[model samples]
Target: MDFQLIFLSVPLIFIAYKLFNRLRFKLPPGPRPLPVFGNLYDIKPVLVRCFTEWSQQYGPIFSVYLGSHLNVVVNNAALAKEVLKDNDQQLANRNRTKTIEKFSKNGMDLIWSDYGPHYVKVRKLCTLELFSAKRLDALRPIREDEVTSMVESIFKDCSAPENKGKALMLREYLGMMAFLHITRLTFGKRFMNNEGIIDGQGQELKGILNDAIKLGTKKSLAEYLPWFRFLFKAENEALAEHDSRADHFTKKIMEEHTIARKKTGDTKNHFVDALLTLQKQYDLSQDTIIGLLWDMISAGMDTTTITVEWAMAELVRNPRVQKKIQEELDQVVGTERLMTESDISNLPYLQCVIKECFRMHPPTPLMLPHKANANVKIGGYDIPKGATVSVNVWALARDPAVWKDPLEFRPERFFEMDVDMKGTDYRLLPFGSGRRICPGAQLAINLVTSMVGHMLHNFTWTPPAGVRVEDIDMMEQPGTVTYMKTPLEAVPTPRLAAHLFRRVAVGNV
Candidate 1:
């Protein structure tokens, strides 16, 4: 009888708390949340789409309750600027979910850390040392070598007698290139051989990384319902296990780098080496260094690949766009040699194509959730302290009000308007805006541009034999990064000299 009474009183208490806050604050209008659960059932698997749908009904700036948590979603350029620019400092903190808390080690890393001195210090380190233009320029050969290796791999596959004219899985090649490039940049070595086979350590790291992603993405009821925490014992155990495994690999790598650095008396340009060399200088802790290293890996690994894959999908779907880019490539970088990163500036059409791809399919549709450090008013709506804010970049890109023929996949639109995606322009915020904008935005752009330019300049992409160009899938798979729903498969016919497809040696840059 006593237990039943306590159980019944819980809902009553929850309702009263919600009501008191509702009366005290002028919260933005939203769907009527049910007691206790608070719109938990209303949210869909694809969260960005659900938010956009609700925005259309409740207006651009609306509220949603994810189990008593007040979430404010902004769906247009104006609201975006308000949240990301005008109120950036007040809302610069990250909203840590159960998974994020586990993955980020309670905000020790750059991406997940709260806005504070630690965040400021790490951001400075990244800007002045890690992601500085000088450092990125020093790492150019790794980028070029990996891209060329991809071209060589693809050429071999397409040139084979049995595989001739057949659809090749572009994701495999692209994924490998992304993996190799990131690992090399971070660790100063490749985990896989030239034949694309993972070494022992590579296999172990790959398994741990895959498990981390799965565990990180898994939805925990405990996150939304605090009373249900005891039910997720196994989930917590899994996260802890992931943490242990990640620490093992990271520490092992650190040890190896430390020994090598002492022997050589010189630090390599790779992230691991840089972190070790700067560890004492920056007053970094072991946890912080590990966190920052994995932060770079987690942030950089898949984003470039996703962007390039989406761009290629569009290029395949629109042959005219493909032809125009190839024409520009030919004009700027002729058939005598492959396109290099230097030629990216001259190939204006390629840049436009990439920008259009970004506008249409920003790799991360929803910017990372920002937590309010203080009570703020955005778009005349009261955002209470601790409220989580999300900017729907996807919705903003597709809004008919902001873009003319927003649904059309035309690269030519960029030619008409000069929109900057590096945080200055609110309308095309692929990398977000203000203080929390991606630090690696330039590096990502350069790699993506180089990869796409080379692919188009080296080969002509088309849908498989039976698949029509129009029938190619453009739907996005739901995750933090919006990957293609159907992994892209295309037929490539070499457009350059065979020798141009050979892999280039990446001498020390």
Candidate 2:
């Protein structure tokens, strides 16, 4: 009888605590949460779309509960500024999930590190050393070479008589270029050749990346119900295996680099060489170095592909936009030569198109969840300490109140207003804002701009035969990174001089 009473009292006390907190704080308006489960069951898989729908009813600033965890979502530009700027430091912490903790090695890396001295040190390394303009300029040849290789491959496929007039998988070439470009930049060698044949080392790296994605997407009940984590041993084991594989692969590459450095007595231009060279100076741990290197691969590689693929899809769907870009490309960079990174500045329309793509289809629609370091007020509502805060970037970009004809795919909109995407402007934040804005924004911009410029300058993209421009689907796949629901395929007719389609060999650094 006493035991039964104790169990009943425990639940009663828990209920009272929850009620007291609710009455004490003026939380933002949101759908009523259920006991224990909260709003977890109500959420759709596509988080951005669901959040946007909720924001319509609850207003710009609202709250929701994912299980026991409270999440405050800010939807519009004004609230975005409040959370990202006004309360930047208080809300600068990262809300790490089980997978994120494993992959980031519990905040040993730059992306997932909590706000503090360690974060400050790593961020400084990134800004001052890893992604400096001088380094990017030195690596320009790799970027140009990869783009040219892609152009050469596409030209061959399109010009082949057997494949004439057939639609080509644009993602295939773009993915290859992104993969090779990132591998070379980080590891100092191309793991795969142009023929899509990968070496043994490439295979290991590819497997590790694929497994990492799988682990990230695979849901774990333990993530939501912390008390039940002890029962979910399988998920933890899988993450452990994934981490081990990554460590093995990265360490082997490091060993090879160390040996080569000793023989040559000179450091290479890749990230691995740089990190090893600067490791002692920065007092970075081995785990931190590995984490930073993988951070670059995971963050840099897929995002570049996703952006260019979206840009190409938009260009194919809008012939007028594509033609306009081509005209600009031809004017700035004639058909006699291939468009280079140096000529990107001369083409204003292309810049507008890239900006428009970022606005319409941001690579990460919901910027990685930001955590409130302390109880704070945003938009006059309480954001409790330790609450997960997210900015619905998708909704912010599509707000009709902010953008004119927000649904339309128009690059010319950027021409009317000069908006800075590098964190300053609240209206457009593809790279996010404040202290946590992506450090590699400039590198991503250069690569995307270069890839799009070359593709448009070399060929005209159109929907497959029998498929009208209106029929191309623009629906998004739901994930941390937004990809087109349907992989983009378009027919390419070569527009450049045949001789210019040849790939130029670039020296490996």
Candidate 3:
């Protein structure tokens, strides 16, 4: 090797020796890692599945390294509760990564932010303005209105002259509807055209945010080693292009709203208006307002879309469960013109369906990484300050000790148990737990339930032509939020003609 190469290699080798020898960690059980890159290779093929398998061998608590980053995986429900709730104050902080920080509009957004005064303020604002019961009720009409349009759109697409009566792409339709409603709530205006077609504005926004999310979630080589920054230049370019589009998207909304507020001078009601008021009161930057709004859109759209799709997928796979849920809906709702949040309590089976979806296909299998503020003891194992911690929510939800037939999707499990999505019940933490738990939980659940319930009530679903129930691709793809590699495409036929399909397929109640 050349002199310069030898000189550089010597320090790297020495540092690797030092990290291996001097950096002592009394961590929980996990696969042994290499000199620099830790258990990253092991997690490459279906991370949640691999982690669950490891938990079976390593016990509830374990540690793994992603290069220099430390990840502590909690597999047991009890310890998960302890870390996410009882000791939340100590564990509320998030690890700031170059990619995530850049993705969060330079950290003005709360989801990627460390727990602090700013994050606290944003969380309180969201809870009071967007998630409050009154706000949710006011938005019920928005959902009803949107779902009606969605149903009509589906009818049009499926019955089109050229379609030959083929089934529509139900998953994409649901995702777009969810995005539009959430966008309206966040910005007080619709991003799509009058006919619900995504306008140019909508496409620009979605394209950018989707690309940014994809890049931000990807495991970059540079993320593991700071010195290897050049490796991700292409990703960085793509990220910047998408970030610019998102910036333009948010800016357009802000400009229009600012002009409207100037004319009306009333700022009493909207979520963004409230934030603008806070910006003045708290001496915050205008960028913070723009940043936070974009934060809500990005965070809300992906997870909600995935949940709706997965719920539908499960419903298609299990006809008995589908029928049971519809029976509950019929009994509770009974040809109701519209469904609302108030209907949730009366339809326990429907709630169970949503709960079971959360358990089986959580949007984020491993929640956003949390950082230890100080040295801590977890399940009798020592974790040093600054280690990146990940609670294996996927593994915990499917743990045999916590749920019967953990691998199966059974809503009855919730009926038999009191597990809840709130931070308190560690057994079912789809939206996560503690301070970092999804601020949009209430809004998200309401949206998911309303959309899924109405769609099922209106039509019955079946696997597409030549696709068998057993042949459905349950295989998941790798991402921060795990999703089916293939979208679930099914023929949605009206339930009134159920007997017509008796020879062909069955749908879950």
Candidate 4:
């Protein structure tokens, strides 16, 4: 080798050594990411599944830069406690993507707000006013009525001679039910009828919400690669239009509520009525009210639908589990009458199935990604400030060490243990944990459990003929929440009498 070439190689070697040492020593252990794209290619499609796969390669706690920003995925139940419990106050701030930020109106709502007095006050107000245990219990009839309407509609469909024992679009029906439920709870009336179709102005508002959710969840390149900001300009413009239209519709509803509440002396107890009362008490802005309303409608409706759909899909895929739940329902909630919310406590098997579903397919799998406000150390690695930290609840629930036969849809595993799902036990925190835990967890529990109970008690579900249980599609469509790639189509035969599906003339639904 030439002496001049040798002289140049020494400096290059020293520089390379220093760079590699800094990266290896400073950053948390994780999958080696590409230069510009970072971990985008690795976690494409479903971030939860990709993060789980990486947890096996690197330890449970590892960092992967999502493009330019560092994202640390915490998949360990033990290490999760460190972030959600030990340092919840410090790490309470939300780490939103550009897309999430675009819709948030600069952290206007309780869900996306940073950890501060505003978040605390708003959260407290919302929890007490809308979703407290007492509030949910008092409003339980709203959910019960919606469930009644849903079962009645399904019963009517099943009663048809041609539709008898035919495959019903379970996901579509559940989504409609959730939509009607949240609508009635928010506005005190059903915009969508029992047939799962929306009416006139309601139809227009539905389109607006649908368009916003679709655009909000659609991944944009600028979110990952900042230099490609020009790529999302068109998307940003479209979102702005959707936002403006949606805001107009929301404002109209608030205006209507304002007038109605004024006439009725603000005596109503529905969600909007409650918010109207709190709006005056707290001096909250109209924009804040709209953002909070959007949060309720967007979160309460879709996530509930997806979760119940997952549970039903898993049941239809596992006939033995279906039979077991049906048997429990039959025993606890007899054929003469329908399953009530109170009956949920008597049916342990149904609870197990619901819990298993929560573990297997959590509604918000990534638990709304959080941003670290300050430098923190976890699992013996340094997480620099401003890194996006999200717990891979999907991965944690399926950990082989924590769960036996993690991939199996066995509800029996839950029956054998006493693990709780209210984010108390980190192992199966479906709703999340800490200061930012889901405010509506209690309402969700009541709604999901009661709905599932009613469904199983009212019908006998079976897969379409010739489709083997193992052959059912379990593939997922990743978005704001991970939903089944295919709609769950199953045959529902009425197990209970038709009259039981209806309520008295004076009662709702």
Candidate 5:
């Protein structure tokens, strides 16, 4: 009986292997995938590097497998334009990962939800109610206030004798500035007062929010293999616990604001207040509100912050480009006051610099994964309805065919060029293209322009006394968004202070 069972199992195993091979679908030629796990092990840890490398070998478009999952990457401007834009509706849905599906409260957040009624409604709310141009203008003062706070903080640091002489980690400071500003915009209160930060606990809220952003985005084994998810179920429980704490904090702030609004009957519109109103109008669940706020926190804090850091790093690396930008800022925005949104419109050189930054360092590198709703053909290859489509914005921007001297940081490329970063020209979409583009596009751009302008106008930056310009650590680290592998630390020499002859002594704190 045992011999017969063993003999029977041999053929069964053979048949199973054959079946798995047969199930393999035709895809664009890529590195050969192994059995069961497919090409999962072959893909690089940094997705941008993998895509950039693969595009070289596979032409503009290629197909690869991720543990049996099919992902089609569009690496050129023409394909990205034709496929992601011209044929958008057919591929409008987000590629639902097991993890995104689970944590999104069963497909609730804007990023994970499919292209249907739910997505449409949420998009409309965000576009019309939350982030409209008029609404953004109304919120401008809040952003200005935040930038002012940041400049003040920098000034204080520069003034401190113990801290004055040392190079400051501008990336860390910029990230915290972005976070606190976003949080204040949402909560409509200075939760982290200036004194609080000075007292060693002011930035704690920003620190917690940053921690949550990192946690939520950290790639997990469960994301790739569903069967092994039970092994790290503790992560899910921990995330939920963190969510509860975040929710409590948000809800408490909302409650206080709501009570004050009711008492005074003042109907001043703020983001949190607007969301509560949305809750009533849409009959949104409590979890939905919390989840949506979490999305705002995560997206707002990380992407915008990383983008600004990249822009600054690029500026620091290319002094000629940086000088041109400062020249524009000086002409458009004089020394009497800080740069504002009104000045952003006339600063073409500055705008070009920002676009160049996007070209070099797109926040996502690969725009969020989009799923095909029905079978479609891109680049003569038939992609099934359920397959995942990734628009390699990073690769597309850097493709030598599309960009002249693609690797060099050149903002002057856009000096007279028609390609804007507004997603209209698919050749250079930083915020993404089609319906899935970032809703925070306008606000993000405005904030970046204002901040960058302010930085250039206020200070002249340099590498530390001994560090060579070429040796400034430009290495990149992998994350949901790329940051300098080593943080951007620079010695900020105040131009105005230097002119006055009061030497800002650099010291190690």
Candidate 6:
């Protein structure tokens, strides 16, 4: 009898141990995690939507397991502030996936660099040397020239006898234009702009860079279950291939710059020149500088194009909106010339249209992962040290509690209240908010808004042949920067006076 009683008590002891382990973490409420895989089975095609659904069921803050990693997703404004602002210092380090770290060159650049003295120093350098208002003003000529070149290129293509009134790939045109603008500004050199078209080796190099970035952004089950990495051998191979191509391309450019620097001692006023100037002061190497250059190109080029394309797609889908914006532009900007960057603020409706697009389609939907430095309480949940915290701004943008008709695309909504995008406004953060907000926010905004303003001022866009307005696919490819699955194709006919289209171009106005 005594032996039997001791055996019965053993089962109770085992139960108590399991309970203690669960209680120790004090993790926020979430769906029960399964053995081995955790919550991996629950993730959907679109991560933001999946998080949005989970937020509704588990409240604003909840814990999730991507394999063994604990991810705390914030889906509301107040909680976003608590994580992104109140505890920013504790959560300043980026939570890089293994693949991303390889692409970031082990945190050599701005976007993926860990929070530390070097990150701080480099950020200051970028702020002062690259993105300062004075620097931006000085680069106005470049922006104007590129914008005019893009407009001229489009007009030429559409006016051609073979392509007249046909569906021109607008998004493709804009993507190349964005690439040209960024590369030219970055190195003070131009490529892929022969006859105002992106072709030849310029296109090839851009493709290689894009392929590598896309590889880094691609989701990996191995990130969660490290031991299962062997299952993703194909992904690993693709990553290495693209990474090698990117490294080769960037190194070639670096060599060219070095040769130019030595021959004439003529430093072009560009990012590479600035970094080379302080190479000794910062103790930076060629590899480190190349990594940083990749960071800038990866972060800058595609996002501006994505934003402008989404904005244009929305406008074309809603003709009333397109008409309304054109009327506003005609009134304020006038058909006499293209809109200037300085005139951005003066056109409130255009701003509102941009705000609406950001609301629906943010460039970085997950706002880049931020890792906790130490254990902290966020929204009454135990966010363990080293845990990843991601603020789903897309979920917040569509929170009915935050906005009326959260999913609807309505620019007029902005007219009712004052909403800004300068990282201060959590409600509409296209460039994110708080300590880790995008360093290049000002430049990106100017690129997107100015492009849209000029496009609206100069042309009347309609849905391409055979495509109904309602048929536009707003579906996005899931990644760090969600690109439209179907490229935006449109028929752009110059609505402005012929002289304004021809004489003023983009920058002259």
**For each candidate, what TM-score against the reference?**
0.97, 0.96, 0.90, 0.92, 0.89, 0.89
lDDT of 4 by residue, 1-509 (tens): 69688556654654565366457557678877665567777776877787788888887888886765778889989988988998787788987766666567668888898999878888988877878777777777778877887788788887899997678888767887898778777766677554556788689778987897778677777788665577678887887788788778878877787897688665466676677778878877777777787788878998899899999988888879988998888888778987778888888889899999999999888888777888777777777677778898998898888999999999999768889999789999889999999988888888999888888888888888787877778877888588888888888888877779783211322
Q: Candidate 5, residues 1-509: lDDT per residue as tens digits?
A: 99688656654654565355336544566676554455678887778788879888977788786655678888888888767777799898877665565456666877778889888877888888878787787777777777766666676687679877678888767876776677766666555543634222334555556556666568776666554567787777866766566666767777887897789876445677778877778767766666666667767877777888888878777889888887888788776666677888999999888888888888888888889998787887767778788888888888777789999999889875778787888778888888888898888888988888777878877777787777876666776577777888777766544332221221111
lDDT of 6 by residue, 390-443 (tens): 999888788888899987789999999788877887787778777678888888
Which candidate do you rate higher for TM-score, 1 or 4?
A: 1
Candidate 2 residue lDDT tens string, 179-199: 999999998989876566899
Ten contiguous residues with the weakest lDDT in model 5: 500-509
- Model 1: lowest-lDDT 10 consecutive positions: 500-509
Candidate 6, residue 300: CA error in Å?
Answer: 1.0
Candidate 2 TM-score to native? 0.96
Q: Write the per-residue lDDT of candidate 3 for residues 46-156, one digit (tens) a residue.
A: 777777778788887877777656788887788887788766877878787677766675677778777889888877777776578876776666766666667666656
Q: What is the C-alpha lDDT of each candidate?
A: 0.89, 0.90, 0.75, 0.80, 0.74, 0.79
Worst 10 residues of 2 by lDDT: 6-15
* lDDT score for candidate 6 against the true structure: 0.79
- Give the distance in Å from residue 282's predicted Cα in candidate 4 to where it truly belongs: 2.0
Flag clash pairs in model 3. 319-507, 319-508, 321-509, 322-508, 322-509, 323-508, 323-509
lDDT of 1: 0.89
lDDT of 1 at 445: 92
Candidate 4 residue 158 Cα shift, in angstroms, is 2.3
Order by lDDT, highest first: 2, 1, 4, 6, 3, 5
Count backbone overlaps in model 2: 0
Query: Candidate 1 at 238: error in angstroms?
Result: 0.8
> Runs in model 2 with CA error above 4 Å?
1-17
Candidate 4: TM-score? Answer: 0.92
* Residue-level lDDT for 43 in candidate 2: 88
Residue-level lDDT of model 1, residues 1-509, one tens digit each, is: 99799778878988998889889888899998987788989888778788889998999999888888889999999999999989999999998887787778789889999999999998999989999999999999899999999999999999999999999989999988998888888877788776678899888878987997788667678888877787899988988888989899989999998998789888889899998899899898888898888888888888888998999999999999999998899988889987788888888888989999999999889988899999999999889999999999999889999789998998888889888889988899899888899999999999999999999999999999999988888888878888898999999999998989998867534
